[model samples]
Target chain A: PSASAEAEARAHQTQLTKPAGSLGRLESLAVAFAGFQGCVKPTLERIVIRVFAADHGIAAQGTSAYPQEVTAQMLANFCHGGAAVSVLAGLLDADFRAVNLGCVGKVAPHKNLIDNTIASATADFSSAPAMTAERLSAALNAGFAQAQQGDLFIGGEMGIGNTTSAAALLAALFHLAPEAITGKGTGIDEATLARKTQLIGKALKLHRDQLTNPAAILQRLGGFEIAALVGAYIGSAQQGVPVLVDGFISTAAAAIAVALQPTLAPWLLYAHLSNESGHKLALNKLNAQPILALDMRLGEGSGAALAAGVVRQALALHNTMATFADAGVSHAD
Target chain B: PSASAEAEARAHQTQLTKPAGSLGRLESLAVAFAGFQGCVKPTLERIVIRVFAADHGIAAQGTSAYPQEVTAQMLANFCHGGAAVSVLAGLLDADFRAVNLGCVGKVAPHKNLIDNTIASATADFSSAPAMTAERLSAALNAGFAQAQQGDLFIGGEMGIGNTTSAAALLAALFHLAPEAITGKGTGIDEATLARKTQLIGKALKLHRDQLTNPAAILQRLGGFEIAALVGAYIGSAQQGVPVLVDGFISTAAAAIAVALQPTLAPWLLYAHLSNESGHKLALNKLNAQPILALDMRLGEGSGAALAAGVVRQALALHNTMATFADAGVSHAD
Candidate 1:
């Protein structure tokens, strides 16, 4: 982020026809964009959303309500442009891509699908580590390579029982109990939620020592798509493209990515606070205030996709609004 | 809101790719719109935003940071399409109108400007009732008249020191101390906020008995634009058009409107939670959950205008997104 561009944007905001700080978060959002883009007039004309699809081995433990096949099925839906994120991408005219980091079954090829499979599925963390270090690095590189040029980047995930993995990851990193950060994913009943919590507790205990290191944490407890999203966040920041972090799983990935590189924090904008019970706690740990809070718990970058319009408007207002002098309006005393 | 249309929308939601409650607030918002429009597929193609501009005589008590002249100045800014709300309305392609409920100085008229001036300015509420019963009724009628044909209605206000009046109204209605509901408006310093709080306390004491009645409360402590907005909310509901209420003053108006006719609550959608201190209390009193919480305090319907995009996308997704059967996707168990 360019300090000079941010300063210029702040000066320009004061000239806009409103009281200083009256626009509040919108003003800060535009200024942040200016800094991120290193231009006084930043525009969100091009948004690239990458939905990383994988299957979590934890699903075998009855941690999620849906079958693991749903992961590959949803990936197919993304390819067919029949998913919520697909519709939202069209609404924002954003470039949407489905990156198959890993899936248990074969995923049919599509023009918009990027096949970068590291493994068919992760190992169930309740019994063992999710992935090897080599596989984790491969997943990270795949996401880093897919971080193409765009005005903004959004990373979403799709994996059955991935919330279990995310909860374990957050519990390990934040050193909190599994029950404190466990939530029902895909609308599970009370029994399933309780079982999921127990499984996460076991996983956290299994990876307790390894949790001290970020790379070890990802290798031991994170799914392929989770690692990919972490890499995507870091890669987007490296490429000077800001990333809009999605819901719980994505935010968990962000916590790992930012832990590895604190500088990436400035490049990340939380899109929404999910309805998932753990989301607020995870977001608080990352010191993020998301743009929307519609209690949306759906993953697949849908929340981030919805927020794209708000970011676009912030840019539009920043670039197009006439100054007080231009409008002949009186300045605040 | 039509129950049959809402039921159809809910059934369609279950047929979508995600879980029944996965989309959370988005699902409820879409269902609410479907019910409001009395159709399974509701569209937000036409949005009408009315920004009521009026001067507050309370500015004479040093209750605000800006001079009262800013009320008329911002009205011109809105007419010139240079204000925050104006830029946001243009971004959303919503029809924007600046209704001059009352301004101290002459405002050059435009086609979009509604000349409904009931008074040059309201009396200083710190000393006396802001408006006569007759003037209050006229202001309400003007707002009611502007609630014409549109898929969605947004009511915003631009009145200097009106927060004082809003706080006084809320304090009188809720039987709370003025300090609890008063906040810094338009970036006031500590001293100014203290002074504003004291003035509101005085006004509340003077209007204690009249505040028991909603109409009397408006006449005693509301600005012309506030009364007009209260009327607009009621009129829009009476006309079967859902209204999106904006910020502190707008919420105050909504409180009065809902108090007068509790049925109007179903016809209102809160746009955003403002940074003002009393806004949350007012919204809680009405049992309303706003769509956005950007800490925005810039009146003129800017928050509502920004939220227009979100509502439009919700409508678009509800109408266009393919169902699980249509898209050949499997549903959850």
Candidate 2:
């Protein structure tokens, strides 16, 4: 956050394992942090995967075909590292951690529960609902502290009907119409699309008064998880650690992070392009092209995890390959 | 070829740099030569790129407008190892020695002469003009002796208006109409195509009496190089070494080899698909898929050299990467 820290991040970038320009965009990410840390081989000693999960009260509206139980089931899977992101972090040799930033029903504190309760899901953020300013700041701090142990961190999200909440937030914050951004989150039929659209329309009008910049928008209409992702990115960047950004809902969190601290944008790696309509918009806003394009639409950081292979290959090519001169052969000279 | 020598060839493939079935096709190739020399690592001691060149006496007939000198110049480049095939063989650590099997005018021999003129070129084969039996047998003997030192061999071609010869070969050999197999050889225009088609029609009529099987086909109408490739394939198979088949023209040689000795099919590794239309037809007839598809159209064993990379990677993946059980990772079952 300080000018000195920003300068430190830039200095570290020049000292990474490969040449200055070879790794392409990956170089940009490592350098942004290196300048902050001011060291070569700035070890990514830990890789905390921050999962912000919550229950959406909008499930009562029947907007999602999936039962709300899937969210908590996935959250439990996250805790056990049985989810796709868990497998990915293990492959990348990064640390795996989760947080129940906010959830509904009778909740018990699980291991590594970074931040708990802010009351379920904020009344759907569609009717008379939004998080208070105090609750929002607390969520942000909880995720930040958890990520501080890692050299870099990856942010993941899980929640049924979270897409509905994200759509509302995007509309209220960016002042975009629902149709331009709204897309089928998970096999929504035409009838469900109309229903979701109308719901977003209503949520935007109610939250319009509270809508300001990203910080105010999150405090009013954001979830406990959204605020935490913003904090995770900032915390990771502040410590000179890069963050692997996942899809759609994670992109929404990324947009919020960027809006809050425009400087944190350099620390982010756009893992993969999702088939989700909002993901393209978010990627376009961020100006990122993902590595793989298998037409995947799943969102538990699976795309990001797949991209780890591409990034690893990029690093290997940059570092291991002998140049034409090194091989003592003329390279089409 | 003695019965015992042939039996020895049948007994084993050659020993490669790695384990059996490790490099898959490549491993099979490296070992198949064991029968050739009756040794484990059947060394390719007698290396010769049977560069069967001819002036497509049809060129003198004005079927091709380019001066016959272009073919000689290209042949010079091939022998100098400055062409693409030379660079590729260098990558694979292969010895690419050339033989001037045939070409227009006189090719004076210094030291590296394998076989010289087998007639300036086959008569256009359009007016009872084809190779005499004595000349065809001499070319075959030269190819066999040149390849006999070790079973492994590669054939390259550089003959202006040779595509016309190839089309006639394909038509007579496969019993097809000229239009069914004709293509833009050496980037000829439509007017040239019309003249070429008519020229082929005349060759078909003239060679109609010699449209027998593979041997008669060679003696009656095929060029010195095509005959040499046929001899080379059979010669290698007889010696018990695997042969790396190049492109369409070579594929034609392979088809003729198959027609001669059916067992030779297993010894052939179809390297890469060529952009030549005839190559696709030939590959389809042979029931093969090439290893790579970089849109190669030249015929100098370039495709085979490139396919070596795929073979190496496949071998590495099969032999090096730790399996799920080996790594102590849980399997899906």
Q: Lowest summed-lDDT stretch of 10 residues in model 1 chain A?
A: A202-211
lDDT of 2 by residue, A105-223 (tens): 43345674444666666556666656677777888887777666555577877766777777767766667788867776755778987898888888777777767788888776667
**Each candidate's chain B TM-score?**
0.97, 0.80
TM-score of chain A of each: 0.98, 0.84
Tens digit per residue, CA lDDT, model 2, B65-88 = 456755554555555544555555
Encode model 1's per-residue lDDT on B1-333: one tens digit a residue: 899999999998888888778888778889999998899988887788989988888888887777778788888888888888888888878888999988887799898798998888999988888999999989999999889877899988988888888888888777778888999878899998988888888887777767778888889988899999988898899878898888998888888888889999899999999998788988898888999998889888988888878888777777777787876666775
Provide the clashing-pair count of each candidate structure: 0, 18
Please tell me how candidate 1 rates in CAPRI terms. Answer: medium
DockQ of 2: 0.03
Model 2, residue A1: what's the lDDT? Answer: 24
Worst 10 residues of 1 chain B by lDDT: B324-333
